[model samples]
Target chain A: MKLRVIGAVAILLSVIIASCQSEEQQEFQRYYNGGKIIYEQRCQNCHSAKGEGLSNLIPPLTDATYLKTNKAALACLVKYGIKETIITINGKSYEGAMPATDLAPVDIAKVLTYVTNSFGNKMGIVTSEQIDKDLLKCK
Target chain B: MKKLTGALFIILLYTACKFNAADTPKLPIYGNRDTASKVVNGKTVIDSVYQTIPSFKFVNQYGDSITNKSLNGYVYVADFFFTTCPSICPIMHRNMLKVYDDYKNVSDFKIISHTIDPKHDSVAVLKKYADKLGISGNSWWLLQGKKEETYQLGEKSYLVAVKEDSGTPGGYVHQGWFVLIDKQKRIRGYYDGTDEKQVDKLRADIKTLLAETNTNIAQ
Candidate 1:
């Protein structure tokens, strides 16, 4: 009788945990899918579809360390566009101007979430709330 | 009804013959052509005069003057773009880099890119751009010249539309065409440089042209 009661409680706990995980997974899937469309529309040309950039003329997004370190600044960079600033990535200095996009804050969050998660990166969802908070601190 | 059947049979046979003729792949010669008739050894000889690219002088990224004569013995592809085009130039060049990598080792192949915005894309700027693009040696040349000269050469010789407009994103309008020129300076083919499939076809066609040593096959 005690084993039966324990089994019932264990099954219920497992069900609750699975449901909880799926909720987070569902949010990730939503952001990733939405961000993929935005990436293809806007970023694919320069950063490339596989994120292998076009030679030294453009910087590759496959560098996870760069993305991780510059996580806070990425939202601003995507929204306002980077000017003729020389940025060093993969030990090489690249000086080029990236045109600005009119993507909204939430869309920026989605796209950032997409880029950071894809391209050999495992950074979790960059939420819209976090993007809004980061935008306020962009230099 | 019998006559109609015979005519339809003949038409089908003719179309089949045309399809067979097209099986051997050959790049089409573009632009207008005229026939020249002359008497050779007391026989009436008719020859087709193909439109060829005229000679022009321009400076390359190395600050070297490159003219049409330098490219006489080599098969070359020509394109027009500025260093700072925000829209299609990057994509065009990105596609073109495949062509560059494929044929960079061949001594008889060359790629020439003319800067339509010569005012900003000077020799130094072009050189810097080339260096940044990680392109070296004479396999590819970033040519810059008088803006009007480049535009005229682009529009008239290559048959590509190019103009300046303030409304455009880059302040200039141009087609993303990679014009393939044969050793004889005739326009052999034109590929849309922005599309990967077209660029792939361009690469394949370049191989076809290189293997096409005999003049009779092209006819």
Candidate 2:
């Protein structure tokens, strides 16, 4: 009986420990407004408020089709503006070289994260580290 | 002599007609005149421009339930943000408070702030934040609810950008915009939530929208 009681207590403790060890909550640092202030000051003029590209002038960020296939292209576009180039969103096409902005890598990460997440487009999180890697690749 | 006589006769005739026309039973300019009717039409068009509020129910800062119906017939500014945001959220929120303070007593205006990060930004946390901001009464309402719903409302309904990002400067992220909703709840325009000059433009537009009568509702 003593052994059984000890065994039960041990099982209970282990269960508690297991519960506490749950991995659902991961430690990840999010962007500060995803460079929202920087984006507004610099990007809102062309991107518009809702991330919906201006009619025929710019491509909407919520373009589900483009988002599915052009993740790298999107990053590259932000890092290096598409001057005198055209990009398509959804089915519509846009022609304009969005000026290559002078934002830091972290700022780029935040703004890209914001654009990806907003405008009915829900891409995963973008990190400054990722931005750094991506920037290096571009160079 | 003949030409002079003809000119004088013509002048007299013109003067007489003009005098008679002025004296004829003229329509009252105050209430029932063409100019008045045109002014009335302009007001009607202005009022028609405001949009209708969509139906939604969410928790308020006081942990109380609030809905779109509560904001019926009121002009309010709506924006989405999370508390721990380390970026434009603070600046945007400060600007929103400024708007609220200026228009709290106006009766026709109100403010709604929705949290994009519902999991972390519970009613309790939002309540604390609102208290910190000194929001009391019905003038300003802080809301939090299902994350997807908030995102949809921000992007589709309000025509502003919002999303859930784990890599934001904080743990969450959203747009830096203050969307202007007229009394009828239509999106009149969007202003830079973080820029002071843009905020001023927002204020002027708000005043203008308020002055215009709510008229059109695009179904």
Name the top TM-score candidate: 1
Each prediction's fraction of true contacts recovered: 0.58, 0.00
Q: What is the TM-score of chain A in candidate 1?
A: 0.85
Tens-digit per-residue lDDT, A50-112, candidate 2? 675444544567676677686655567776778656665666566545666677887787887
B107-168, model 1: which lDDT tens digit per residue? 88999999999999999999999988889999999999888899999998999999999999
Ten-residue region with minimum lDDT total, candidate 2 chain A: A23-32
lDDT of each: 0.91, 0.70
Q: Which candidate is the best by DockQ?
A: 1
What are the clashing pairs of model 1?
none
TM-score of chain B of 2: 0.72
lDDT of 2 by residue, B46-120 (tens): 222223456898999888888888887787788888765556765676667678778888887888899988898
Most accurate candidate by lDDT: 1
